[model samples]
Target: MTVRSDDTTLEITRVFDAPPARVFAAWLDLGQFQSWIGPEGIDCEVELLEPRVGGRYRLVMNTPERVIPVSGVFRSIEPCRRLVFTWGWEGDAIRQSLITLTFREIGGKTELTLRQEGLGSVESRDGHVRGWNSALNKLDHYLSGGARR
Candidate 1:
């Protein structure tokens, strides 16, 4: 309904060594996704990703400690510019929360702005903030090591 309807917002910023095109492809392609993405120290298996507007995908993360599942539906896809999607964890009753990622080029680098909104509560939003911070840091390393589509 409203941005951060629970009155909390999760925003994370990270710059990647790759261009926006390559970074975007890493999110769209399953093989590249499996290679990089997910919380630190967790393994991810993508069940599906349609990669087009209105397409949806489900991914399973099998951590040695626990398993987490997330599904997302693409809302917008502007090549090398922006992407918006609805994301929901498997066991959550509230679904269809939004995540918007914007890619801006600065001095031959891609600056990513990740914002996940509509968290139901302060706890949910806070948890996601920390999680995304970790995840994006990994993305930084992944790209730093020359990861590409």
Candidate 2:
């Protein structure tokens, strides 16, 4: 995976050894999402999920030390191609951010690009960078047939 970031935005590009539809499904499918959505050692529970545009979703991520609650509203969804959403922690001081995901087919594999904008600060963006990279790494393992964490 490749990562790029600025004070207010983060972008990640990763290629998965799976078809575009499969990769896209991982994001919208509850079982698949719960199986591989968090960083190593973090357990994630989907509190609610409504994948259609204008729908809402919520998650509770548990780590050894803390519980993080996040929720979002879908802005757009295009099967096997793209998704756009609003993301924010349930009670955080930070403002809500927009995330866009693009999927491209390449030689039977999928190239996924995730872009997050409107982070409140560089520190917030960096934290998301770390979290997302770790989560994506776990996703890679999941796609390669590893057992869920």
> What are the per-residue Cα lDDT tens digits for candidate 1 across 1-149?
01232455677767788889988887888787776667776777788989999999998988788898999889999999999999898988584479999998978888888888888888888778766766676667777774531
lDDT by residue for model 2 over 23-126, one digit each (tens)?
99999998898889877788899888898999999999987889999999999999999999999988974779999999999999999999999998999899
C-alpha lDDT (0 to 100) for residue 134 of candidate 1: 64
- Those runs of model 2 whose alpha carbons end farther than 4 Å from true positions after fitting are none
Worst 10 residues of 1 by lDDT: 1-10
Task: Please report how far candidate 1 places residue 97 from its true position, in Å.
Answer: 1.4
Model 2: how far residue 98 lies from native, Å: 0.7
What lDDT score belongs to each candidate, Candidate 1 first?
Answer: 0.79, 0.92
